[model samples]
Target chain A: MALSVQRCWNVGELSSDALRVAVAVSIEMNRDATPVADSIRLVRHSGESELLARQAFDTARRAIIRCGVNGFDLPAEKYGQWREIEMTFDPSNMRIK
Target chain B: MVRFLTLLAALWLMALPVQAQNGPLRITIDEGVIEPLPFAVPDFVAESAAAQQMAQQIARVVAADLTGTGLFREIPQDAFISQITSFNSPVQFADWRAINAQALIAGAVSMEGDGRVSVKFRLYDVFAGQEMGAGLQFDGTEQGWRRIAHKVADAVYSRITGEAPYFDSRVVFVAESGPKGERQKRLAVMDYDGANVQYLTDSRSIVLAPRFSPSGDRILYTSYETGFPRIHVLDVASVGRRVLENQPGTMSFSPRFSPDGQTVIYSLTQGGNTDIYRMPIAGGAPQRLTSAPSIETAPSFSPDGSQIVFESDRSGNQQLYIMPASGGEPRRISFGPGRYGTPVWSPRGDLIAFTKQSKGRFHIGVMRTDGSEERLLTASFLDEGPTWAPNGRVIMFTRETQGAGGQSSLYSVDITGRNLKRVRTETGASDPSWSPLQN
Candidate 1:
């Protein structure tokens, strides 16, 4: 799931400030692993300001929606286990500083 | 009893969600692709017959500006699944997503009876299925339609990337003509993208390295009008100029304004030795900042006006140094395997951009204030004189080809060494100094 969504995440689209922070998005998915529309919300962030937090969350949300358009590749038998997922996007290892 | 009841309620709430049965699946994504975000910009809606042509032209310029950054790829109009027919029409996010447009821009152009034009635009995050920011509108003269288009692009870019807007700014550069050996240079100002150029000085006298003031109202450049190199400050609006430094038997050049716009710092050569100096813009005694016996020039101020970065050859080879804005001992910041010169501090006060010559090749590079994490953005036969965009995300400089027919032109590269492009000009251009964003 992480690799599937990482392919659609473009960190270059984030600002320098946004790049320095980490954001966690909570998403509710249907049984087929497709994210429920409007179910994505920023659950937690390390950003210092509201603007930076919003920017980071938006970029994270885009990655999920863009990759989940065809539904994420996940196990159907464990649908209940992965119905609600928390994805943390951290760019500290990639940021220039 | 109350404590027991509260604990029971909390436990019940925690157990209600299905994820509570087994903690929600947590995943960490630490890596991401570094690719241009795909975007689409349809022709702006024309609100009046007079603005029909301008509506399409404005949209085209906006698209060019965004794509030129190399951070964005514009989907061709033919591939667009939905057409924006009205300014206030509902956007079909599904159509945009079908075309894989991560972002969308919709705009409208209208012309009033009094020769004024208004351009309004909205940016959308297609997959998010909503507008990225509030819609914005800019009003200006009909002749300034390009500026309006740039403004719209700037707004969209800022909202999407969280970077400051720089497209609405202007650049002051030396426009060159004639042969390479006998170049006729004049000072000229134009839009950041090299459009709507207006000459500030004629070609009769040779000019070099024009720098825009903090407010973009005046220009400081070195000229040989008096048979010797001297610094001159010119009013960008009236085209009137006066010598800023005219000490007897001394030469001064490479002038830049302090962030406050009250003082100018440049290099002054006297008695065959050069050093940096600062003086008030309103005519005051010059104060020396460096007493080095080597050539010290290309002084640029930090955004907060606390320090100045300049190039000096005191260590046997040209290198960048930083010193207190007030005269003080300087500290070397460049220790690379090459000669560095023409150091300009970034407006954001994070990095210093310079021209480096190594192994017979010239390059434009940027480094942190401490001379660490040095990255070269361009390499060519001769690339020099880097000036930062208002947002400090881009650097524009001169790149001249080799040989007798070699001519100088302006080129910009992203600080990350991407989107290297030649700026279009009527003739040869060089020594570009970008101005601050316009009011």
Candidate 2:
């Protein structure tokens, strides 16, 4: 059976602004990342303008990258299974998928 | 993936400054590790009452420009062991060396009876115990005192760095403000440091990516005044502008001038396909240079106008390509993992600065003309549009924050990718095009 997994982590010591920057860098460093709005729409169900959604998603994504910058924890035994991952983070649910 | 080295690695914060020159008075900067030469800028000797304030201010600006480069550190006046009361005074190298000042700049400011300001400065190699060159003087209107200071600083920077002076150059960029949903952008011009900013157009229309001509007196920009992007050229001195002629139903943007300032190359969009074209600066029929099914834009000419480097998606993914100036078969230059855009050829003709998107990150990077030795200088959320410094040692680009509160600002990073700093501006700024050194 095919398995899919999602994980979430706290923003850590970096302020959301810094993480947003990190996320933006991550978005920029990776060319294939969707237009910021498309990614934001996946998680933003609230009546938020594209601007607010972009900000909220950027903050959450930045948090993820900031924590991952120095290396993050993973099940070493299943490294091959989880070698690559992509997910949309929902701040409302504090969930990552 | 190539990684950028953190700036100044292995250097302790409280390390003592070294003043004694072991051999030649030079600091050859490596990839990221650099020892900023300690320098001193004493208050310029004031020759008249009107010149006193200007003298003090000039020295401060000169010091700020040098220290901001990350290649030089200015010792505070409190650490100064001796004062420069006269421009012609003999240097007391020991005193400067005591404060770990490897270089010294001494200047004199005077006011002519005709209300003009005269500024003169000399740079010294404190350890070498000699002035680097003969003292130079700049004369300008009293109201333009800052320009005079900049000229003096430019001379000092050039003498020390062995690069053409960018301190005396101006930047043309889009001044931005307001909410992300309804942003306002206007074309503006200012000194490289973002002072003396003057708006060239009103906020009623959107402006993007203003580029300076090689002569520094004319500017080309993309404007939406007619409700679609079109190229416009303006005379800097007069602030008068005229949009380049457009073929019906076509949109033109991303315009740049040739080295000779007689021709312009830009991108034109029609039938949902974009291609590069060239036209005379005085307005004439544009000669199509590229015919492709994919998008081809952001064409920049080499220093000699022999070739054009531009972005295209002729491949399944966006990549950079080089073609002859007259347009013919093209050569693919980028084979990296991600897409590249805004390939600006360096004025020195040795490298191309570009924006790279890879691994879910955006970067401002540079590479050789042949596409080897790729170095990512800065990685951020939205860094794009790299323009070369007059000397080609530095690049200035636009970096916008992510999210609603996000706004665009101008940032500069050296070609070595060692120093990254935000350029100070009164308002948010982007799409900076650095001009050639002023005549």
Best-fitting candidate, scored by lDDT: 1
- The per-residue C-alpha lDDT of model 2 at residue B260 equals 98
Candidate lDDT scores, in order, read 0.90, 0.74
TM-score per candidate, chains pooled = 0.95, 0.76
Q: Provide the lDDT at B75 for model 1.
A: 95
Worst 10 residues of 2 chain B by lDDT: B24-33
Q: How many steric overlaps are in each model, in order?
A: 0, 16
lDDT of 2: 0.74
Residues B1-439, model 2: lDDT tens digits: 1121222221211111321223211111111112566789999999898788889999998988777677778899998889999888798987986776767999999998797888888888664456766889898988787788888887877666545677878899999988888899999999888888999999999999999999999999999999899999999999999989567798999999999999999999999999999999998889999999899999999899999999999998789999999999999999989999999999889889999999878999999999998989999889999999887878999999998899899999877686799999989999999999886
Distance from true location, Cα of B289 in model 1, Å: 1.5
Tens digit of per-residue lDDT, candidate 2, span A1-97: 0000022223221111222221211121122211132221222223224433333343344334333433433334533433333333333332111
